[model samples]
Target: MNKKKIIANIVKVISWIFVLVFFYWAIKNNMLSHIYEEPDKFLRLLKQHVTIVFVSGLAAIFTAIPLGILLTRPKFRKGEWLFVNIANLGQTIPSLAILALAMGFLGIGIKAAIIALYVFSVLPILQNTIAGLDSVDKQTIDAARGMGFTPVQILWKIEMPQASFFIFAGIRTALVINIGTAALAYLIGGGGLGVWVFTGIQLFDNSFLLSGAIPITILAIAIDYLCRGLEYLVVPKGLRLARKTNG
Candidate 1:
């Protein structure tokens, strides 16, 4: 059909082909045999990894979104810069260092890992929410106010809908980051796929390393694609149409 659609189809085909090739290589080389041998243990580690990522991401979303919104309000506007810097500090610090500090205060366990992951993952969502809300058209907001809409009603009905795209983009970024970082949770005695990876490192076993790494890479990519689909669903239809037309 059209050039853009044709290019998109080609890209999609190539992506699937690549995935199939990678899996075939893994199987042919027996890179995943270790995983297959202990299917239950592998599954349990996968579950733990998924749980850590999901819980940390959920916590970040709940805290950051509301705080981001509050920062945009008149009462908190003056402190926006302060809070943004604090969030930035979290990103600037190494995740390992964060975990170490957390261990001292919160002890070494899943709790520390979750706290560290949550801290590390907050900035993207927080910044994006603020940016999205701030970017809403002034004219639209004024129009809403003129229609006798309360501030809360205007925000809920108008601003938030417009900002959903940026917010979701932030969330997608945070989730991907959290997934990668969760691999380090095993360092804190938090069980996950990282257990296999670290054990491989200790024993100098390539297969064990691949067993953990391959699944993590796959999970991250899958979750990213899932979030992309979610972005389409959550972002308003009108906004999507407008974006397409503008592009």
Candidate 2:
């Protein structure tokens, strides 16, 4: 195998090892027992929280896409730095603080958590999208113009197709972050996997924590791999060739 293949394999092995070790620690600590004892409650929490994740994920995507487009536009040159700084600031804010602030108005449950997670998740997707759009070559833009493509046509037919990989990469990151943060929703009674972890921590029930943590970690990994597959499908052939050549 080539050096790059070896490196990829090593990374995969390390990831698997990390996951397995964490799972073992949680299980040995009996983190999942509470949820196991009452299957019905566990199911209810899962149902309640899944909706929160979906809502939060959608909110982040909606906010990010438009902001990303606006930030990447040439006309908005002066505003770009300000927007990037604000997005970066969003990443720095503590999730707990965001949740606390939202709870006063939203009154707890998944709604508050959804708002917090959605807001926090936007930065990655937005930044990636802007960068991706900016990365498209100026020569390509000129060629598209020469070919009689309108601004919309150029964006949809040329730029967006090339930038798709970056956008999807951002989404993949957001999805994983969403899954992990969904657990924190339990703090406000949003009742997802975090309910198990939090309850287990409070009651010293290793089983409870393990049940929640294990499933979430697994789900995140599964979704990440699935998104990578989707990214491969969507990425343009030229980009793929370029990547291969660069490697």
Candidate 3:
């Protein structure tokens, strides 16, 4: 294996070990006592949290990917900057402020929080989609053109296949970011694990704090690994081999 692969495996091993140790410690110290006492509440919040993440993430993916494709077209290229800046606004503006604004327009609830998250996620995915499309080796496309491939065919069979990795990277990053930020959903009564986290802050209780915090951390890590695996599986093996060799 290459040095990068070795180092990555080592990191993964260490991460899993840390996760195991952390969970054991939490259980041993009774930090999870409250979670056990209210299993139903825990499950409900988990479902809400996962639902919020999944819905927002899916929306961002659909919106950004198509918009990115539209922006990359030759006719639309000049206007791409406008959309990029618009998307950047989502990132530049504070998430809490976005949520507040959403509350005014959409009202406070899961919908508001989901909109805030969708906005936050759009930038990275959109930027990456543009980037991934741009990264398709021009020479490769030129050769396809030489062979009589239509623009549409070249995009689906050439550009997209090659750009998959970078696009997935953006998705993975956004999802992980979403998982962490979802904790704030509680502030607006969106109902997620954040409830306990902020409540613990109000009451100054470690157990309550950990009950939410630990799960968020674990959820982020788990989602990241899942995305990473999906990236590997979805990207062509030839690309993986080429990347491995290049790395």
Predicted structure with the largest TM-score when compared to the true one: 3
Provide the clashing-pair count of each candidate structure: 0, 12, 0
Q: How do all the candidates rank in terms of TM-score, highest first? A: 3, 1, 2
lDDT per residue as tens, model 1, 1-247: 5788789999999998998998899889998888889999999999989998999999999999999999999899999999999999789999999989888888878888888999998999999999999999999999999999999998899989999999999999999988889999999988899998998899998789889988998899999999989889988999999977665
- Give candidate 2 misplaced runs (Cα > 4 Å): 17-37
User: 1-247 in candidate 2: lDDT tens per residue?
Assistant: 6898899999999988987887677667765565668889878877776788778888888888888887777787679788878877667988887888778789978789888888778888988898889889989999999989999898888888888888998998988988888888888767788877887799886677678777787778887999889888899888988977787
The alpha-carbon lDDT assigned to residue 162 of candidate 3 equals 90
What would the per-residue lDDT of candidate 3 be over residues 139-245, giving only the tens digit for each residue?
A: 99999999999999999999998989989999998999999889999988899999999988999998999998988888998999899899999899999899878
Higher-TM-score candidate of 1 and 3? 3
TM-score of each: 0.92, 0.89, 0.94
Which residue pairs of candidate 3 clash?
none
Which lDDT value does model 2 have at 93?
A: 83
After superposing candidate 1, which stretches have Cα over 4 Å from the reference?
1-16
TM-score of 1: 0.92
